[model samples]
Target chain A: MNLFKLAWKNITHNPLSLLLNMVLLTLGIGLISFILSVNTQLKDKFEKNLADIDLVIGAKGSPLQLILSSMYHIDAPTGNISIDEAKPFLREGHPLIKRSVPLSMGDSYKGYRIVGTDHSILELYDAKASEGRLWSNLLEVTIGSVVASNLDLGLGAKFQSSHGFNDDEDLEHEHGTFVVVGILEPTGSVIDQLILCNTESVWEVHDHHEEAESAEEEDHSHDDHEEHDHEHEHDHAGHEHSEYEHDNHDHRNDMSRSQLLEHGEKEITSILVQYTSKTNFQALSMPRNINENTDLQAASPAYEINRLYDMMGTGTRALQLIAVLIAIVSAISIFVSLLNSLKQRKYELSLMRVLGGKARTLLSLILLEGIIMSLLGFVLGILASQLSMAAMAGSLADRYNYEFSSWQWHGSEWYLLAASVGIGFQAAVLPALMAYNTDIHENLSDA
Target chain B: MLKTSEIRHSYKGTQRFTFPEIKCDESSSLMILGKSGVGKTTLLHILGGMFKPLSGDVSINGTSIYTLRGNNLDTFRGQNIGIVFQKPHFVQSLTAEENLMLAQKMAGNSVSTNTVHELLQQLNLDHKAKALSYKMSQGEQQRLSIARAIINKPGLILADEPTSALDDENCKKVVELLEDQSEQLKAALVIVTHDNRLKQYFKNHIELS
Candidate 1:
């Protein structure tokens, strides 16, 4: 009997057309909502991972690639920088630098990179071991929370790393095994997917791989050099060669393992640097000087990530524009449908007028129809976006180790709802006016 | 009670119509008869307060209905005038019973579902009350329209060509229903039509030229 009930009934009267209109609007709003949530999550995770670190000094290569690889762990390392060449920045008492954590990465277990880094890097992520303790010896490792669960490597679990970032069993470094000494708390950053160990672990595995390759060469009759004589003793017996023989061979070798571990021309993948104070001019000048004069590349995570965003912004903006265009088209569709319904209901409206219903009463009934359609579309659109986000959550987490939840509200959603309702109002206004100005006498007498 | 005097109307490019004065009292029925071009519908509209006459006055229940303007005029019309058009019309989406309730609501009258149900039963349309307004048979729709017209207990009931589309039996039944409902509400009834079949049914009637 009420206008609202009447309006609802009218909408349902032509169920197919109203449903089509609602679906059009739902798609428009759903697309924008989906993009808003995903984009916000990406920016949030990027910003969180970029926290506090002033500079990344890595091997000379593309500065963006270096930042992406060394800091964000999403790309390959530029190259290795010799420790001798990076000594000035690594020194504890360096005036401009507050701390530096050295990282050497060339190995991975099941696609999760094992990062050979100083224990200080754990502090950078505010990470603490959830079980056992941090790595204290070469090849002893602490796994990130996500890594531990994904690989199911608990405390005291042992696994050997492969030669590079791929999961190739052929390149396994069977000569050395990394034991899980600790599992870190979830930091929700790149740290959550890393295996933390000391820089010496990287050198130990690669060095042993080198000697094993050399022994294979000797086995193929490539050389009979004096050094090849010691290769037979520990050829591939799971690194169980005699300790006395290892010591004797170490003395006879060009450079012993212990000597190489203690500063004999070793290389590290990158160094994460922090300044004494953010406002200090050295923070800016030091990176500039290093990029200009040295064999290393020093990049700021903030600058590189912002540049990435600019490159990404064009695609996002275009999509948002398309979403807006869809909404406008939906508004036009709503306008046409309402006008048509008004035309079809002209006789009924004239009857109402004859029965002493005011012009405004008929107008309100039509207007209520428009508002109901838009509000229904809005609710359906929001639910669709959330369901889609829930579906994507698993894949995003699996691939990037980043979690995305659709339940989180985006700031733009309220504005989107308002715009949708406004479009509904705009669409209905002309039709409502038509109903309001209905020539009751003419229509009734004509009928 | 309802009365009209000096009512005249003209549409653009159409002949002007000056209607004859008429008066009818409570609990009575009157029919205004005319052929196609005599402006019987126009006079009905003026009497119902849906259209303002070129120069005329219409009063129902001793209050000048046309003196009210805009919303107040609409309120007065809604409260005092009940109209049934030649073609039965209802908000298509509403059921038969809801159409009556809507009439009461639009007239700013308190709606009682019990009254609506009882009216439908009395009109022999209780079986059709829950049916979609457009889905009912022609006779059922006509009765429902009559039910809606009397739902607000208006002082005057106007019917425009109500029996024009009916057969002899339906036409006679419709005239009796209109008179019976108006009598129950004590409202003066006026039927405007071009049909001669209704002449034998109403004693107090006028023919428009």
Candidate 2:
């Protein structure tokens, strides 16, 4: 009997048409909601991953991709800068710089990425293991929750890595098997998708593979390397071939351990640094200025991830505009249907007029119907958006190294709610006026 | 309270009918009996402020109805007149109570649920309050239409061929409902019909030749 009831009944006067209208609007709202939800998730995950590092220092290239591949488990490293060249920044006793966490990726264990870093990187990032402690030796590995779950990996488990993003890449490494020592919890951070281990571990297995290759070569023609002369010392079987003999061939004879590290002889992948204090940022001017200003490109992960989000701005806004445009179109449809009903409703209009309705009262009733339907539609739309976000979280998180939870309503979501209701009322006004201005006697007689 | 002065009108692209001047007030029932196409509808349209004549005017009390237009005309028409069309129209979407409630809203007056209940009781339609217009029998719908017409207590009741489609039993029931409702509202009643069977129900009769 109220204006809203009347308007709603009228909007749905033709049941199929009203359902068609709701379905169209629901889809429009659903698309915008999905984008908005993903945008929120992407921005949030990037910000969360950046929590471990104050900055990334590396070879000059795309800073965002560098962060994506190195800090997060997406993309490929932009090629390693020599540790000898990077040694000044990693100076163990530097007055201003704290310890750096080096990361080497591009190896995978059955599709899950393996990240090589020191145990200090785990402590520095506050990465608490879900099961045991961080990797203590070369072959030992500590992996992320998603990696463990997906690979069905546990402590004491061992696996071999192939090269690059897919299995088609090189599996020719001489050293392959890595033992899992620890597993991290699902923090919903990039760490959840990573397999973290020590830097020397990358070189150790590959070093063994090189030794085995030389041993097998000696068994054959053996002319490729002349110094690798193995006498028939087969008395101890697996222990008889000197492991130290092949290690000596590729390593430096003149350089000491510190000098070997300084000259890039002991290779590591990428380094993540945290400034001990704000003042320390100013003190590390040479490396910072060099990375940003010189041939090498070091980036603050926060800045570049935000830049990537900014790049996605146009696509998100366009989707939102399309959603609102369709909602407005739906509102217009409501108006058209109501006005059409007015002509055939003359006798009913005259009867209403005769019964006691004022012009303004009739107008209010007509307008109220549109508002009611829009409000209902708005409620339905928001529900659709929430569910869409949950569905996208898994695939996007796995592939893009990001996740979207419930969208925070204070930002763009508020605008969506307003646009729907405003469109509803805007559609109602014209039809209401038409109903109000109808000629009573002409209509009654015609009826 | 309802009266018409000397009024003249002609239809566009036609010249077949002329209407005689007639006035009916409260305390009387005016039945204008005639064959089809004698301008009874045109005269009804002029009296309800639905049309402006080529000459003369309609008045309520002493105020000219022709003075109102647009929503003002709508408001004046709703507050002063009750109309029952020949077909007894009702919005298909609304229930009987809702149709009556709409009439009350249109006159800018508050009619209580009790008022609607009591009016429905008088028309013997109280039991059918929740029925959709089309769901009710034709006789029931005609009664519900009458219930809707008087919800706002307009000063005049205009029913055009109210019983035209009914059988003898139902037509008598419809005329009785109309007569009883006009007396209850103190509305001057006017019924335009070609059927002479309705002459016995009205005190004042205007025949158009």
Candidate 3:
């Protein structure tokens, strides 16, 4: 503790130099902590939620996007296929296809990416809502923690989709509105950045899209009268269309048994399938075979994640190596400073030596000085890192759909602290040797 | 009381000293006089345990003090023996008070303001307590050095060229301070110098050849 006070006094005594050194040190440590924490948080999230699902079977164009979207909820999914096209496998139901969960992406509200998936997304992943129950009707949405916090949304809150990918475009989704029925807990994964609704909501939104646009135009012209703005023009456009089919939805729940045969491509973005286990390779192979032979393509999730890691893994490791090098350089700086002070403090050293101070005592004092400085530098590093994390929270959540926890010491924080202190103490070796020898007679003769 | 039995020391390739038996009894003063390079300073340093003689035995109060080596020797030197050098170097960062305090702390002295103040006033350095040694005049700095030497009230007081840089008046005052401290503390005083001015103050003197 006295060593810390002395180092602190020395640093504070030269405020300008101290400030310059601190700024450089903070930047170096700040960048390292940010990069390491982000990587760690991502590794943690992937290792947590993506455990059960071995491979993602989807209509894959870019296998990485397919995995990132269906598995991590980040990308825009590839187009959807027919349940008739989907029905063969649903009926085949190989043991490998433990359960197939269909996902209809491409629907969004405001800037929130909405995944039009069935309740199986929650069931397969073993996630539960903290606020309200799952979506029952079409046009209903379930928000995640980040979504709720960022958009100020909650259960029973209404929202309208923007035109593009998670952007608040001037034009809203032509469908009426989506009422938030549930809010998921903070999973600290990509899912927390999304807005989830039923697949039917996606279907219904497209169904009334053209009519909603036409009706909106009519209202704009009719708004000159200022009488019909409160008439719920949006609700009526989408409500009438659903009402026409409401009577027959129960019968049409299963597409193979549908009474009315629809025309054009049955609109769907993609289907995400999970297997019971890798041992059920026979069942999992059936879907891949079906997709390969049929219209859709089933890509493996493990392969995609591994490939993504391969693509980014090199650069990340390189950056981490650079951080380690910078830290080593900092340790060397400590060594140099301590070594310099030893020469200037010769008289002081001899004085203490003459006062019954052991050589080991002086050595510990120098070593303690280095450890204290490194620990202090590390503290400043962590603080700077957290501030950077906060600044990047929103954009990171939106882009990669990754969430960062508020800065605090975790299980491994102590390991980092210990490593820094060890580096500091070891760096003191050069100076420690000087103090250990101290040349008692040289200083004494001069004295 | 102090005694050196046949001490021998050499420097460079040629300089040598072979001292005969020497002694300083309790409550007495002894002066060793010689020209430059005649081992006057070397003998003083060896007695204070600053350097090891090539061959010799030194005893203080009948104890073989040479057995306590290195830093142990240093502690014994600070507490039991006080040395006044031809040139005294002070830590530039410390003030007059701090300078005295450092020596006092090393000697385990009580750090009494009265003792420090009296010493400062006797040396006419009371106004410079807060002033750094570098800021003081040479006479005042020499006086502070004397103050530092006696701060511990050591058993053996050794002074070398203590008056070399002083005016006659200041030299008399410095010698008076030394004489007063030696008697008050009942210490063995040994002065080594080429200066003849201090001959009048001491009763026992050795003219080194």
Candidate 4:
């Protein structure tokens, strides 16, 4: 009874062809939407976790890996740098430096990282304790909201940490068990997956480990040293301990073990630095100075992540280009189908003319068919993209502790809608014109 | 009333036709008989407003239909002229009733489903109202074609060899159906055909020599 109703009938008249056109269009649109959603979320997570850190001074290694391990908590650390080597950046009232938080990351509980740092990290994440209170002792620990929920840990729960960043519970440091004192609120950042403790607990656990290993070494070498040489062996062990202490000192005399534990641990993994101001000159010059002039390596999170983006952008751009190409090809397929159907419908169009149907009426009918087809395809495509995103949500949560929601409407989708409608309109042009200019007499007479 | 004055038409690189002028009153039927190449269909097209004669005018009722241009001409044609094309071509996707409704719609007239259903009932096709046109039998399709033509209640009815492909019995039935519908609606009926079998159906006949 109506043009649109007529168009719907015509499109449904050949269901297989309609399905073919819709599938091609859906695949193209679904791929593009998937890429857009992931790309937007990834960029958002990176920018958020970067969180105003200007430089990361860690042991000499790949700057990208250092940023990944410190800022993203996804990669292995670049060995360890002594606190003495990293002290200049963390000193009180140091020029060109606003604040720095040193990290000691050689442990994980379950699969979640157990980060050793100061309270400044809590301030960096704007963290609040939802249960109990922040860690106040050497062995007390505070778990992030995600870590607490994922591991099902609660207040007063005690768990040992593995020796390194690996998830193996067999390598757990049995000498010390960290007691959970607090659980943080959900921050929606990497902090939500961390178990935060002070650096002293990490040093103490490793120190006990080193003592156990040294005691076993003495048991093995007792026959070679004899009873009189035991005193000499004590002198040698004291010398070795002093040498280990000197690794963290710069010729300062009369240093205590507590001072060593506080400001000069034999090793701290990395330091997160913030400049005094955005316009500070050292932001540009300091990373270069440290990488070339000091034993430590400095990395700017922004620069390394941009490099990551550029590398990722190439693959994404290629995929996006392929998606666009598929869309264009589907448009052509629509055009071909329209043209083919027009040929078969010529006499029918002429019959409409005989029934007083205008040329423009026929033109509009064909165009309306194309528009209807495109609208159906667009709706299906959006649903397909959402389904794919939902399928990917679980793994993304497991791997990056990132949540992916499929319910958001992207602004880019408007452009996609326009593109689809435009393609439909464009594809209908020739067939509509052919229908418009049909010779009623010849067609009716021929039939 | 229907009238044509000095109508003529031609195909590019083919034959030309100069048609004889004719006139018919309401409730009357006229048959245009011709041989295979006499351009009977072309003359029908001209009278139905499907084509503009190279040099002539066709007036249905008091208005010169050829003088109306674009959609105005289409609207006039839809309101005043009904055409039954040979072979009963239709929008295959639509049902018989819907086709009639479409004719009324395209003519810019308000579609009345009651009127369509009533006409199909009177034409003995009410049982097949929802059947697709291509799925109908030959006799049923021809009747559906007649229903579509008379759905708008036009002042003139034009048929282009509506009975050419039928047998003697169906051909006579189709001719009677056209005449009866035209008389009932008080419209001038015109049939263009090369078939001699319809020569006895109408007394008002024009021979296209």
Tens digits of per-residue lDDT, candidate 1, B1-209, equal 88778887888847988888899999998988888988887788888888888788888888887788788878888888888888888888889988888888888888899999999999999998889988999999888988888888888899989998899999999998888888888889999988998889999888888
Flag clash pairs in model 3: A79-A269, A80-A268, A80-A269, A96-A283, A96-A284
User: Per-residue lDDT tens digits of candidate 3, residues B1-209?
Assistant: 89989798877659888987889987799988889878876788688776678889898877667888655766677788877777766645567877777676655555577778888887789999989787898888888887888778788888889998888998998898888888888999999989999889888998888
- DockQ, per-model, please? 0.76, 0.47, 0.28, 0.70
lDDT for each residue of candidate 4 in B28-97, tens digit (9 for 90 to 100)? 9999999888888788888888888778888889898888878888788888888887878889888988
Per residue, candidate 2 scores C-alpha lDDT tens digits across A9-122 of 766767776776677667676677667667666677677778657678777787887888888767888877667666765656656557676776667766677777666566
Q: Give, for candidate 1 chain A, the lowest lDDT window spanning 10 residues.
A: A252-261
Per-model chain A TM: 0.85, 0.77, 0.81, 0.85
Candidate with the larger TM-score of 2 and 4: 4
Better-scoring candidate (DockQ), 1 or 3: 1
Give TM-scores for every candidate, taking all chains together and pairing residue i with residue i.
Answer: 0.89, 0.74, 0.81, 0.89
Model 4 sits at a Cα RMSD from the real structure of 5.4
Task: Residues A1-447, candidate 1: write the lDDT tens digits.
Answer: 788988999999998889889888999888888889888988988888885888999998888899888887878999988877888888777888887888899888888898877767977889998999988666788899989888899999999899887778998987788899899999888899899886667767876876877767878888666656545432432243233235434443222223333462567899998888888886679888998899888998888999999988999999989988988888898899999988888998887876678989988988888988888988888998899999999877665556677788878889978988998899899999999999878887778
TM-score of candidate 3 on Cα atoms, chains taken together: 0.81
Model 1: lDDT of residue A105: 90
Q: What are the RMSDs of all candidates, in order?
A: 4.7, 7.0, 6.2, 5.4
In what order do the candidates fall by DockQ, top score first?
1, 4, 2, 3
The local lDDT score (0 to 100) that residue A314 gets in candidate 2 is: 76
Encode model 4's per-residue lDDT on A261-360: one tens digit a residue.
Answer: 4555357789989888868776678889999999999999999999999999999999999999988888888888989888889988887776778889
Better of 1 and 2 by DockQ: 1
Candidate 1 wrong stretches, greater than 4 Å:
A148-154, A157-177, A205-261, A279-282
**Per-residue lDDT value at A159 in model 3:** 75
